[model samples]
Target chain A: MTTNHNRLTIHEAHKLLKSKELSSVELTKATLERIHNLEPKVHAFTTITDELALRQAQKADEFIAAGNSNPLTGIPVLVKDNMCTKGILTTCSSKMLENFVPPYDATVVERLNGRGAVIIGKSNMDEFAMGSSTENSALFTTHNPWELSRVPGGSSGGSAAAVAAGEAIYALGSDTGGSIRQPAGFCSVTGLKPTYGRVSRYGLVAFASSLDQIGPLTQDVTDCALVLNAIAGYDTRDSTSAPQPTPDYTQCLTADIKGLKIGVPKEYFVEGIQPEVAAAIRAAITRLEELGASIEWEVSLAHTPYALAVYYIIAPSEASANLARYDGVKYGFSYSDTKNMWQAMEKTREHGFGAEVKRRIMLGTYALSAGYYDAWYLKAQKVRTLIRREFDQAFTKYDALITPTSPTVPFKIGEKMDDPLQMYLSDVCTIPVNIAGLPAISIPAGFADGLPIGMQIIGKPFAEETILKIAYAFQQATDWHMRKPNI
Target chain B: MKLSREEVLHITRLARLGLTEAEVDRLSEQLSNILEHFEVLQQADTTDVPPTAQSIDLLNVLKGDEVAASLPQSQVLVNAPRREGDFFRVRAVLE
Candidate 1:
């Protein structure tokens, strides 16, 4: 019961729960025990709701008994700490909100609760989702389950690591700049960044409003589709949410990609990519071709090289505006040892935020400052327009683009921490999709030196089904997704 | 691209952040280095391209002006660091 129940995927658990062969309470307990056992090593969660989970599981069992079950019913899932959960801590792994609990849930949490999904806990992340590694988390760093010494790629590192380690059946992660996909790649999990506005961001603590997107990190592609069906749709609460209709994503998961056109962007396969990682992705491309995806090798998005520069300017600029709410008045951390109101506010932020958070805030303030606003912020946004236009042009010629999710596999914990520039470059492959507002999925492709590698499939705006179909087909022919770390 | 100490201090003031001398010194150097990376943007030709504040095309989404249920004052003040009855307590703003 202990070993078997915790390892079951959402799809597998759904079958067991529906058949009455395994009760949700039993499943929840087993999962909770696994989380407790692994918490010391992985440090995946900021808060574990074992009591809340049991109560929710009991309700889920009653719902299942009444034949009112859904795909996520009775499923134990973890959420990244950035999303608010009513009466639960939503810290964003920052000291600024370390003791903060919200009075309302994020829209995604509400939807998951509506589906009878048992909330396991809030996972850790970089402070305000600013860095590429979980090392910036004010709480603690989440280690890659595959190798404890190596860092799990982040700021969604805790979500990816939890799913990989079977701490939760699946978890929700937000991607601003490759936060979801890069960590999913590092941990060998299946992750998707839905098209911008596909999911509501109403109660998500904003990092960069335009680029931030909430998506799933799961064990396999089928589970990804099932979770997407439960969460994706228009929300009147989030004005930016698309008014387009949400389809049953499960219908698009057929393991058949006969005539799909897949483009390989040359810019993604640049000089910095690890040799084995490139070879693994190239091999996956060949496999897709064998399974009937026509691969075009010479695709070029000329503006790709400038995405990093554009993202740094644009994300921080938006973040500076979005983060001004922590002013020591309404909620979260406050500093009392100050002379006046202004001094109190200033000291609150200075002491509450971590180094990376402060760096981004300073960078943003500088970029958006009066004299330099046009030269830095405005220029980056215009370049962003060019970058988006390039992806728009590429999508017209091909159904979707394929690339390596990250340039390399997971690195040792302290390897890239000292150099911020070096750490930012780790996400080079996955950043452009967010810049263009496209849907992208990262799936397990292969392994190098016992570490996992991932391949990314990016689709047109509101074209999640197309990318899911391709990823589903590729996942069917590979055994990489089936392999688990011996942790 | 190098930001002088005065420039860093000026930016911090605008950002409303209080920092120690050590942080100020380290940040001036680090911020300058990151800015050096942004120099590449000047090379790109974006003559007539408009700045994209958001990627999605939706604009001016209007809804009926209906008052929705609001959180109770107690619930809203539950996480406040300091509160006086219904109002949040803070250092004196008006001298």
Candidate 2:
């Protein structure tokens, strides 16, 4: 049951499963063994579905024995806790829903399981997906598999960490702002924040309904494409889910980047970028240029500076409404006997949420409140429009935008815990994509002082295939994604 | 402008969180720091800009009203922390 240190990619895993070289049970057991060994140090899982996973694997084996084969038949994948999995504990890394078990599977989870992919467990995340670092997780902080002392960037921290630590072959992560990409960068894996509606968010615990997206975190772009093929489609359950045709993402993997236009925003390369991170990103762009991809400099996203402010306002505003459902009466944790219903709700929320989650809820409530609605919420939305317009203009001229996934490498835990603003700024480069509802992916570009750095590839709405193609091209040119953490 | 203790408590209440005086004191400072950082938004010339809620230009995805399967009430409340009959139970609202 030991994980093959040289585990095959999802594409290769499917090939082996079809050829009868590997059984789903064996793959699931290997991943479970890896989780048992590494999860203590990495804190990647909020709940490991060991028993349930074995049952699913057995079922998958039965299907294969019956000569039924699908794209993801017998593959094991992890899901972020934020995405509800029916009959499993779906705590969003918050005490508020510490005991809540969802009654229905998230759209992506249903799709994954429908394709016969075994759900390994629920991964940890920021409380309600509100923080940049998983350190804000009320349940447990997911540590970077590379360096245990550092954070796996969040709120998809556990998914990124688990995949990087080889605990799971691939995982589903929900990205609002940089949740998926930042953690993917820190963990040295590949993660895609598919176009906002590319993957359905029907049962995902909402952080910001408008900005949140569900995507795959995997070992490589090819695996990402495979997972995307399984998960991305129109779902009637999610009204916002796009009705556009889903492309075969793998088809673009072998496409040459001979004439692809890659835009490098001068605003992203400003003075504050960490030297090592900037150097690694610059090296990646240079490598792309060497591969015959034309690099365009001086492309401007003039609203870049306001993206953080706009996101903070808009996300929180949506979060305020989204999180209101956890009133301690419907499900999960509730306070002990209290004087009245109001007191019970107040006590439960007060005790349930961690600091960062409470801060955002407060900011959001205030922004959406009567007096400040026009001044803050409305104003932020207007700026959000401008930001989207800017991206639209840029995309008209360039195929995709490129930037450092994060401003700096993963900082020590607790270094910026007291400064929430500083932590929010960590997502400065990655937020605009979510704001614009475009597709974005983070791939391991290179290393900075032994820590991994990620290069972000952003594409137009519903252009997830293009982003994956670009990432696949970059990955083929480098060995970064293949480099595993010593842990 | 720095946030007052009263404003901090009001915000916490609006967020449905009960904060102790000590927590309020600490949060006031943290909230003030974050607000100060956002002060730059005040200078943004959004005078005539229209508010943008969605990224895509598409809007109003309407569907025909159709019957959908509803979860059994028992299963829906299966995970409720406290339940009574078919409804989720809570602390008594009235004295």
Candidate 3:
């Protein structure tokens, strides 16, 4: 048994399991022990399923003994708390669902289990996946594994932190607006936000139904592809799930990007981007060019600047409707102190939700309210069309677009907590991809002041295979993905 | 684009949230700042452009009417905060 089995990637673990060189039980135990030691410093998980994981690992070992093991068969993974897990406490880091044990598994979780993946625990996230930093979590903040004082970028902060800290081999995170990629960038891991509708969102707790996507955060581009292959596909339960057939993602990870046309959007290199991050991204693009991929410097996405504004309006409006279901009756927190139903519901929300949740609810409510609906929600929707059209046009001339995943490196834990707009601005480069319902990946580009920077590759809708090929090639050319935090 | 205290209160009521005076005051300022940032949308020319509620080309998805196994009542009601006899219980809506 390898003592450092916790540091093994899914591909490495699979090889050991298949060759009878290691058992899933040993790998799972190593991972759980690492998680136990690091939880105090990282605060990465909301709930740890040690027993469930051991049981699943035992089953996976049996599968491997029978020579039926797959890539993720014996690998332990962490799930972001927003996804439902049968009989497991699936809190979205809000007091509202803090004790909410789901009755069934999310489609992605079901898919993971079907592939014999052992789920270790549920990682914390921003309350309702609403904030850029996990500081907004009602439970606790997840620290960046690289720097304890800095935030693991959110709302998928905990998942990214765990993967970086070697607490789990990989993790699943839902990205509404850069939730997965931003944190991955901060933590220096590889994260991919699959094209909208590429992965089923059936049991994912809704923040904004149209914008939310479930994706993988992994140690490398290949592991990201492996996790994606397991989770990506259509389901009848999710009406928006694309009916398109999923390709064997692992086959797309060929370390070759010859003759590929890549574009660098001038809009993403806006004024607020830190010079170090900009330089790292430029270096990454130059590397891609050296890899024989054609690079375009003059590509323009004219409506890119308006994505943040459009996202705030549209996401909140949809959230106001999606979150209305938490009415103290159905399946979450409730207040029974009052006799009147209305007062009880109001008090439930007041006590159950954190400040950021209330702020977003209010913002969404105001946007969708009668008089302001057209000005805010409808106008944002129109602008959303323009943003989508821009990507559509860009895809015509280029196979993919590259940008810095986060404008700045990981910030201090509480730096932007009080200033929502400043927090929102950090997602400027990533929000446009969600608005366009496109696929994007964030890979370790370089580092600045000891913190990691990520370069994002955006692809056309339903073109995950194309982006994965590009990311795999870049990752092969650079050794950044192999760097680990000292935590 | 600053919002009034009354407007903030109205939004809270519409959203079914109760807040302390301090929370309301804080939110009024914070929300106003966010809304002010959103004013950039005014500069966008969306004239004659169709609104996109969904990004992909998905219409009504029809499933067969055949009966399938559903969650048992005991399992479905397990997570309810207040329940009685397989039904989620809520406070009285009328006097």
Candidate 4:
């Protein structure tokens, strides 16, 4: 048995488990033990479902014994706390839902369970997926596994960091903005944010319902494709889920990118980018060019600079309406001390939400307010159209767009904590994809200051296969995705 | 775009949040700063563009009105903060 079995990929574990050399129970135990030992240091998981994990592991072993095992059957996976898991304490890293346990699983969770994947636990995230750094979790800060003092770019920090640290073989993260890919870049893992509506959002706690997409973060692009294959499908439960056919994503993992055109948006490579990060992105572009892909420059996303502005307006505007359900009534925490329902709801929100959540709620409320709706909310939506149109225009010429996942490597934990604008800028490169409802993947491009830098490959609407093929080709030529953090 | 204390208070009330004086003061400054960032949207010439309410090319998707079993009352009520006899118990709203 491999001593560091926790570090093995899902594909590697799949082969071992199928051959009867490794049992799912042993794999689950190793993952659990790794999580247990590192919980104090990484603070990756919010809830560890040990009993459920073991039971699921036994079921996986049975499936393997029966020779009915799939590629993901025995794999141990962690999901961001925002994705509901039946009978598990699915807190979105907030005190508001700190005790909220849903009676159902998310559609993604149901799929994972059907595949017999051992769901080890729920990873930590920004409260309600509101912020960039997991420091906004309101419960605890999830430190970067690579450098414990630095942040793992969030709100999917816990999921990305856990995969990087080998606590989980693979994890699921929801990306409204850059929640999945940015953190993956910071941690040197592969994270995929599928096109909106490609995966069912039936049970995901609503952030920005339109932009919020559940995706996979894994050690390599292959695992991302496998996990995507399992989760990408339609359901009547989510009316917005696209009825588009989900191709076998794993089939697109070929290392051939011949005769494909790649785009590099000039607006993405502006000032304030760390020098090393820029150099690595340039080097990765060169490597891709050498591999037979043509690179096109100055593909101007004219509305790029306004993405952060548009996202803040739109995401929070939806969030305000979505979060109004948490007013101390149907479920979750309540401030019962108040005498009236109105006072009670107000007090519940006052005591329950953290600073960042409160700020966004306030921002959303202000934008969607009576007098300013046209100026703020309506304008942002039109600009959002323009943003998407830019991508639509670009995809006609290019198969995919490549950019730095984050402007800089992971910064010190408290560096961007006090400054919300600086924190919001962390998602600038990754935000436009969410706004446009496109699929994008962030793969390890290279290292800077001994930290990993992620390069994003953005695809057109429902073009996850193209980006995955390009990412796979890049991974074949480089060892960045294979570089594990020494946590 | 500068928000007054009264304006902040009104917005907070609209959002159903009871922020403290300290929080309100901090938010007054922070929300103003955030709104200033949003002022850039005015520069985008979206004259011929229609607003994108939904990003996907999705339209009026209607499901059959067939009666499906709703979640059991017990499971639905299980997570309620205050419950009484299968009903969520909230403070008096009519008054």
TM-score of chain B of each: 0.94, 0.89, 0.95, 0.90
lDDT per residue as tens, model 4, A1-487: 5457988998999999999989999999999998999999999999999999999999999999999999999889999999989999999999999998999999999999999999999999999998887999978999998899999989999999999999999999999999999999999999999999999999999989989999999999899999999999989999999999999999988899988999999898997898898889989998999999999977887889989999999999999999999988899889988688899999999999999999999999999999999999999999999998889999899999999999999999999888898899889999999999999999999988898899999998899999999999999998988788776
Question: Between candidates 2 and 3, which one is better according to DockQ?
Answer: 3
What TM-score against the true fold does each predicted structure earn?
A: 0.99, 0.98, 0.99, 0.99
Clash list (residue pairs), candidate 4: none
Shift of residue A316 alpha carbon in model 3, Å:
1.0
**Per-residue lDDT over A244-350 for candidate 2, one digit per residue giving the tens place of the 0 to 100 score:** 99888889998488999989998998867898898899899899889889999778888889888899889988998888887887887888777688878888888
Candidate 2 residue pairs in clash (backbone atoms < 3 Å): none
lDDT of 1 by residue, A1-487 (tens): 5679877989999999999999899999999999999999999999999999999999999999999999999999999999999999999999999999999999999999999999999998989998777999999999999999998899999999999999999999999999999999999999999999999998999999999999999999999999999889999899999999999999998878999999999998887999999999999999999999899998998899999999988898888888889998889889988768898989999999999888888999899999999999999999999999999988888999999999999999989877888888998998889998899999999999999898999999999999999999988898899899998
After superposing the true interface residues, what Cα RMSD does each candidate give?
A: 0.9, 1.3, 0.8, 0.8
Q: Which CAPRI category fits model 1?
A: high
DockQ of predicted candidate 1: 0.86
Off by over 4 Å in 2: none
Q: Which candidate would rank higher by DockQ, 1 or 4?
A: 4
After superposing candidate 4 on the true structure, give the runs of residues whose Cα lies further than 4 Å from its correct spot. none
Task: Report, for every candidate in turn, its global Cα lDDT versus the true structure.
Answer: 0.93, 0.87, 0.93, 0.93
Q: Please give the lDDT score at residue A143 for candidate 2.
A: 87
Chain B global fold similarity (TM-score) for predicted model 2 against the true chain B: 0.89
C-alpha positional error of residue A114 in candidate 2 after TM-score superposition, expressed in Å: 0.5
